[model samples]
Target: MYQLIALDLKAARKEKTTKQKESLAKIALLHQNVQSLGNSINEINQMLMDHDDCKFICITEHWKSQDQIINYGIRNFKLASCFCRKEGKHGGSAVFVSLAVQCLERSDIRSLSVVGSFECAAVKCSLNGMNFIILSIYRTPSGNMHVFLEKMEQILSKISDDSASVFIAGDFNIDFSQDSPNKQLSCSLLNSYNIQQTIFQFTRITSASESCIDNIFTNISPFVSNVINSSISDHTAQKITVMVDMNKPANAVKKRILNNERFLCRLKSVDWQNVFHIPQNDVNEQWNYFSNIFQSIFEQVFPMKTFKVTNRFTDSHHPEKIKNNIKECKDRLDVLYVISNSDNSYKPCYNKEKSTINY
Candidate 1:
């Protein structure tokens, strides 16, 4: 049974390639510097369509306003958390989590974010009986490196947990492919926290330049990652896979006392004659007596009920379920994105998808 969460972004059916689709461990992630999420929403959707198992989406340079991001999001996945520029028209970050996972936004870490130096959005994810923090970060090429390093340390210090892992993904604009003062200091800072840069392949490829500025940093063990050529920008994307124990109750377990018509009827059915005929003549004392009686009946009428909460949708492997949810997901997409960036509203941020080929 393949459980699902996150956006409803799907693509037309295609023949499966040699890509690894099934895994003994189920947690998978996809990271990209989309240039502009509004324009690249379709591409991002299509990418998730091909790699349907990817539950986490980390994006930098979303280039959308906080207002716009608040109004729109992908269908199946929850737009877990986001940070957009206040003054500038570009440079922002977002973290999307699967519906099957539970995460808490780390605003304490996010409050430390600054525009030019360090911009980030982080979430503490609790999945499959494990806890970890996923941070999506971005820094400008000309941004202040000193401030970036300082804020990064504070952010790391605040979120550091002995029991939880930390995963950082971003376009830091510092080329790890070449030796430079910026690269050295950044690597040293991350190394201090035992977080190592994971992607080694050149992420950006142009006829004139090739660089590895886009990367993922982590201290997680038993994990594997690869560079994927996304035609979204000069910057390529990345995918990370980790096997985690799935037997534990992971998603979310919630319990509630059902307050239904039966409860209401039972409450009214109670013998309230005693409350009215109480020995106390004082009005306050009589009300208190009624309250106690009401409380006693309330507890009896409503009993605690527990259930495991899971996302309504499931992964593509469950073809029948996925197909049925497609229409329902699209309906939600329409309401969230009333402007409708789904098909025809996109303007190419860098290269048009039709002109560029992605794997």
Candidate 2:
């Protein structure tokens, strides 16, 4: 079975009675190099389910256009901004902010970004008066480092360090696990602004080689960073935990479904022998027989769930107001009917459904 295999956020909150449990940090962001997002939406969706409180999700190498990314939206996250190459073959950047968080896309940054050099999409997020900017960056392996460094300086020189905390995360194609000229130059530029690389462990590990090309750099201090298996990408995913609190959606509805890992295990445990050996030879009957077998299994694995999401700013259907108006109209019609039958003076007041009901 695919277990959660970490300090589940809910478990940490509930078990905070213990002194050690109280030290569990709040996970603020999740970043991964999803080579192709269309192929790994389920894995990312399941990860989001595991960490419902997570604020930001950034991915590199999405290989999607703006229209494609719009069509491939995540469940609880909003598309803050994204960038796709206009000239190159593949490689794109996307940033998805939690719907609960207040965020605005930085189109200015996108305008200055160079695709092969410092390809990135950024968003400015505000929570409880604290503001921070997240840059989902990606650089091609064969791309020129001078262009990357020059673009970085141009963009960084424009933004002041004191305005907001900064988080730069994604694949740079420059390994930080070992020291090199490219890494040193990149570090010098970022460190000038006090933004430091947080993930030093090798993110891409294979039988032949290992490298820390995928990384996260942030100006926020005193953070905890870890590399975990994403189960979808060859490069491991990186997550960061900070002391600050993420904005919890007081109004947004939350609904829980069966865990994906558990569902797979339950499917394997079910007995499908009866489905395979159905005695009926009729095609329709055989279809129904298999359907019933799967139906029972699905019921056992996944129960019903109910949830509602209300937008605080706008509403499409004011059902309560409409219901009250309907009730008042019915009462008026009833009174008119009673009066018309009791006294001829009020005749023809109520004859049909819409007889006297004014719009």
Candidate 3:
């Protein structure tokens, strides 16, 4: 099912003419459960088309059968979905993308074999030769959150190595509240991989007087930009926008290395090995140390001046620098694990054959 849909702004910007800057556009995540009355799909489409800035609209939980989907034929958008015979409705999740941006690869809608659930799929696109992967997730209601997350963790581990920029959004059906950590159940594992979790409460936000459910999480750092509490759906939809800049001078690389060193030094110096074994509770102490390190690296490496490209939005396959950064981050994680006596599960960091250690 299409839990989430994303458009590559960097790709869309290329097609814009000089006079079309005002129409640069915005991406919106409009969450809705169409099964309920008074929230027709046609109304949703009409409301979305009214937005001048809205380019891509990601819809979640369209609880309609296959027959309704084919017969209704909503206009000016491409829809993708995964359905199951639950509650006599063809419901799970679905995504809607504006017809303007071209879909580079076919949609992946199937039962993710790892878990025996008919939920989750991905769509791929190439913007300036950089690949982007957007995945949709829906955990089974009967299954424990841990079991679902474990399966999800295994499935994602295989794809993390891909160079494509990844964005995962959906109806996780799990609450991420710290008050009752048990509510976390199987979904807690996502917190381990730098995935930022934000709640989008549909049930409460629509009718009740509360706000805490539904979510969007991603490992892509700095979170780009987002709009929460938008009123497109009964479920509060969040719109996230990201900008990737790659341009730098040769001297900047050396300076960035120096910056990363300073970041490392700011933390209390400990033998790297001892630091790794810190219990989950104490991981924060270690994270404060390493997060600074990553921020330092990201700050230096992410600026467009780091690479020679003038317009990152137009250049093709220009992520050679970002690829190197991903590699460096992976290496740093490995070194931390080895030094800290932690087992190398190889899930949080991507493992590569050529990623040799340099002691």
Candidate 4:
């Protein structure tokens, strides 16, 4: 669940209301280090309060010290660190999750220190039972720009596998177009990992330069549904709506069936009861037994097909467009066997056999 606000939030600063419910997850990547943050934190907190139901929050290039973070908890959100509290103008990366959601797991809450690199953190969490990985990235000043980008690509590719969904968002420092030094490297990594890239326009910063440095990319799992421009910061925040399935029952069945490693391990672990246990069964026999078990499990879990929008974008204007986009994203997820809902999470609709209407 990633949504970007590509503007300086300081201008429209307002407090959160008691009755407002959060309907989206927000992620902000800012270049303003702690020293220059001004009143942005307050502005951001106010915005978060508005969308109180949105659980997760991630911010890159956070220049604040750990003491400051510990003393004040970013209004209502809990903060996680990925960098040490160094003195005097030193800034790195940090993450924030809402107080309403359960704390699951997080990556090395330490800064990814490279010679020219800024701050970074890799976080792992399950939103409404859907798992996703987020990386806060920063670039350096020295070395072959291409080589630096290549290293970054290597890191992303190494972490992303066929099993989990991955999202990397932060200040890239360099653009992704052909003229940019790391364009090829950026394109190669994104193409290989199937990540989404977006640029937002900010008029307040860079005088009037329309720079597109900040980016958001994803691999597998919840698909990117949209990207929105912001009026909060000098840089445009990306609003990415990730499509996640809500049918938990069917998802459980699919997880057991599709997880080849786990499934094989389970098969090896199963012991025969006192009567008529077959040994070293052929592939077909094993498959038959597996299918029967799966069928029974599915019948118990998913008795009917249900459509629930688990993840979505609040700023998105078109409902039909968003629905269609979500369907497409689900199709991609089905191919990877990563959709969360066991029944509606799979392809061609889970009730094909009992479907009353013809295609």
List per-prediction Cα lDDT, in the order shown: 0.67, 0.69, 0.45, 0.45
lDDT of 1 by residue, 1-359 (tens): 12332222221122122122321356778889988888888888777888888878899999988778866576578888888898977899999998888887877667778896788998888775577789999999988876686677556544432235678999899999876656765775575456788888999998999899988988666788999887987788998887765443335422223343454355446564555475646645555555455445545644334345454212222445433333332222222122112212223411232233221
User: Tens digit of lDDT per residue, candidate 4, span 181-269?
Assistant: 25433553364345656444431247555555666666444544333334455555554555444333222111111233343234324
lDDT tens per residue, model 3, 1-359: 23332345544565564436543333333444444312565666566565534434444455555455544444676764444334554345555555664554223223442232435645654443444555555554453543454345544443433444456666555554433333432343354343566443333343444544455665544544443443445555555555433221112111123133443343224343444665768765655554445344445433222223333232243356444544454444443343233435333332432255332
How would you order the candidates by TM-score, starting with the best?
1, 2, 3, 4
Model 4 TM: 0.52
Assess candidate 3 and give its TM-score to the true structure: 0.52
Query: What's the TM-score of each model vs. the native?
Result: 0.61, 0.61, 0.52, 0.52
Rank by lDDT, highest first.
2, 1, 3, 4
Instruction: Give the per-residue lDDT digits (tens) of candidate 2, residues 1-359.
Output: 13453547657766765644454435488899999999988889987787676788888999887778888878888989888887756799989998888988878677767877788898888776566788899999987776676567655644432245678899999999765656765775576456789998889989999999998888677898999887778899898878753333323322223343454345446454544465645544544554444445545544544344444222122545434434443433343233323334334333433453443
**Number of clashing pairs, model 3?**
14
| Winner on lDDT (2 vs 3) | 2
Question: Can you tell me which runs of candidate 2 are displaced by over 4 Å?
Answer: 1-27, 245-359
> Looking at model 1, how many pairs of residues clash?
5
Between candidates 1 and 4, the lDDT winner: 1
Scored by lDDT, model 2 comes in at 0.69
